[model samples]
Target chain A: MTCQELLDLLHDYVGNELVIESRTTVEVHISGCLQCGTLVHAYTHTVRVARALPKCNPLPAAFEARLRAMIEPELKDKPAE
Target chain B: MFDPPPEKLTPEIVFREYAPRIYNIARRMLGNDADAEDVTQDVLLQVVRKLDTFRGDSQIATWLHRVTVNAALAHRQKRANRQKHESAEADDDVLGSGGPVTPGKRWEVGPEESVLAAEQAAIIEKAIEQLPEPFRDVYVLADVEGLPNNEIGEMLGLSLAAVKSRLHRARLRMRDLLAPHFEGKVTS
Candidate 1:
């Protein structure tokens, strides 16, 4: 496979969406070409770094209070089920 | 974190159980607490409104996720309109359309051996922030949240093909952005 062709399929390869034949083609291409290999390494590494970053959490208590204040009235105003 | 059955679900119960998930989605997309709060509040209120006719659904988490994504994307569009010309060039300038890629730098370190240093995380966050809006949306949902491609497509109102295309380009952009900061394994 050409370098551009490998780049085209790189995302699917990483996502595990490629079929066995396509997967093998990508693996073979990456093995021989250091440049393409670098792209693959960097590509996967980028995803790993991003996934490792701590996600936002706890939902901020003060804001949760404000949200509850808004929604509570709506629920209260509704006739009891 | 279990709660009442769907038929018995209350807005309070939802807030207690799922507010953090809703707020987390918004916080990641909007990139700031202020906007995140605004969208989260709106989604929560909307859920309460829908809960009036609340027939039990087996997958509240999936449904809630769809709601959160739509609200966040709408908020982003409004913000973009208000602050027109924030991005100087087109998205194409930032995202290559599967063009020939020349490998310049090799960030060859294996991730499994590496620890997540806070500084590296901060740099990655900044790179995410710099991505064009469309790419950023797909990247955040697919990579950051680890949602399946089909679900991300549904949430973003994109076709599966479009989702794949944008996501791939987004990763390339991210890889380029971060390569400078990471030392190659062979920097011996």
Candidate 2:
């Protein structure tokens, strides 16, 4: 695999959707190529950082209060089902 | 012994536990707190009134996920003035074919620095928000929420191929946007 071929295959490799033969070719190419290796590493690192994003954004105090006010009446009146 | 699902489903539980999660999903999707708060409130009101809808067969978390996605998408639609910013540089993907990635420009940051990336949350969030319309949706669902691609395609009414394409583009865009921060910062 040349550099462009490897670049074209980067997404498939990152997604783990590449076939084994194609995968090995990519691995072999990057194994010897420092630039491609760093590119691949940085690419994977980007996805990893995105995955590590905080899963919860806490409701601000005023927003929480308003949300409570909006729902409290319905919770009191409606029979849940 | 496990508490009955009913015992666990209370207004307080919804407020204390699920609300933050719903807000987070909306915040990421809407890219702003005001819009997120609106969708969060909308979903919470609906959840409290019909809390038992998912009581028998489905788990509350699963149901909330669907509801939150739907609500956020719908809420974004109501504000449908989002300009088409499909950047001209869509072809300018990171490390694209025939693009030269010189060694001097490659990221020197290693995997161990991932923990520190969280401290750069402002940049991360801005990069995500900058992603043009629909690609942002797929990126959030796949990378942020960790949802399966098929599920994301279903939610977005896109085919599997479309989801894959959008996600790939989103990742490439993200890499280019964040490279300035981490690149050449050889963290020891």
Candidate 3:
């Protein structure tokens, strides 16, 4: 597998979506190609960092209050009918 | 595949259960607290009004996902229109820019770097916000929400291949945006 071929398959490789035969070919190529290996590492790290992004902070109290207020009118309009 | 039908949901139940998640998706997509809040309210209201129409054909979460995405997209369109009307020149500049400006902070190589996490998160958030809408949606749903490609495709009405393609492109863009900070950190 050439560098460009490996690059094209990087996403599938990282995603584990490649079939066994193709996966083996890419792995063999990456294992020997320093540049391609580094590229894969960086790509994987990029995914890891993105996945590690801070979880969404809880909604602000003020915003929650506002949301409740907004819902109240709707609730009132439908009163247990 | 015979799965049990989704349970009937009440407005209060939907609000209590889904509000936080819905708000999170909106915030990530809209990149503004106020706009996200508005979307949350608008989408929840939509759910309440349309509850009777929900036939249990899909999970409640999937239904909410569709509604929230639509509402967020609409909100974005309205904001874009208003900005365009207010100042065509400003709109042109913002629209013309491919991505947010690279963060100004320089990277260093040690314990001092711990302080940079918050800034790094902010920069990533901005970079995400700058992604074109379609890619942004897939990235947030896939990477941030941890949804599978199949579910993302179902939610976005895209094919599985399309979801994977968009996600790959989105990840590559995010990597480029963040490469400066990760320099020296990633190695062979």
Candidate 4:
């Protein structure tokens, strides 16, 4: 494969989204091409770093309370005569 | 255990299991604490109201992500409308001014890798926040949430190929945005 084609497939390859036959082709290309190899390595590294972000945004109290208020009436009114 | 049927959408169970993930998706999509919180509330409330209609065609989290993205987009639309109507003023604030910019500064990690990882994540988040809503929504759902292409396609009401195409462009844009930082890391 050419450099552009390899780069285009880099994300899919790193994320394990490629089918076996396609992945084998890409792997073979990377094995011989230093440029494609670096792109894949860096692309994979970037994805890993992005995934490491701290998922830490707690919902606001008022929002939760409002949601509870909206649902409470429904819960109370359900299953009643 | 797997999620119970949608009719049994208990807030306690939902909050216990899915809230964190929901919050993460919202934060990535919206980039603000208040908006993320509002979207999370909206998603859960939506779950409560719409539970009976869920057909269990996809994973519960995938379903929840669809709700979450819709809620976040709705919130953004409302804000945009408000801005248009009032000719709203822009806030002259710097990044990291909203919520805790970093997660768990108290948590430990290997020094060099952690610093590089943190910087890389910040760059990515900024680039992601700048993407137009259509692509941004798909990117967050697919990459950040790590949902399958089929599931993402279902959530967005797109064909699987469409999801893959949008995701590919999103990745390319992200790579371009972060190329500066990957200088030493990538060989070519």
Index of the highest-DockQ prediction: 1
lDDT of 2: 0.76
B35-139: candidate 1 lDDT, tens digit per residue:
888888888887777775555775666777788888987887788788895642226446768668757667745658445777777788888888787888888
Give per-model TM-scores: 0.82, 0.84, 0.74, 0.66
lDDT of 2 at B150: 88
Q: Tens digits of per-residue lDDT for model 2 on A1-81?
A: 788788777878998999999999999998998878877887787788887777766789999888888887887786433
| Candidates ranked, most accurate by DockQ first | 1, 2, 3, 4
Colliding pairs, model 4: none
For each candidate, what is the lDDT? Answer: 0.77, 0.76, 0.70, 0.62
The candidate, 1 or 4, that scores higher on DockQ is 1
- The fnat score for candidate 4 comes to 0.18
- For model 3 the local lDDT of residue A18 reads 94
lDDT of 4 at B81: 82
Alpha carbon deviation, residue A46, candidate 2 (Å): 1.2
Given candidate 2, what's the lDDT at residue B53?
A: 59
In angstroms, the error of model 4 at B121 is 4.1
Chain A TM-scores, candidates in order: 0.71, 0.86, 0.76, 0.64
C-alpha-based local distance difference test score of model 4: 0.62
As a TM-score, model 2 comes out at 0.84
Error of 2 at A71 (Å): 0.7
- lDDT per residue for candidate 2 within B107-183, as digits (tens), equals 65556554544558778898999877677888888888888888888887888977777787777778888888878
After aligning candidate 2 to the native by TM-score, how far in Å is the CA of B81 from where it should be?
Answer: 5.1
Q: Candidate 3 versus the native: TM-score?
A: 0.74
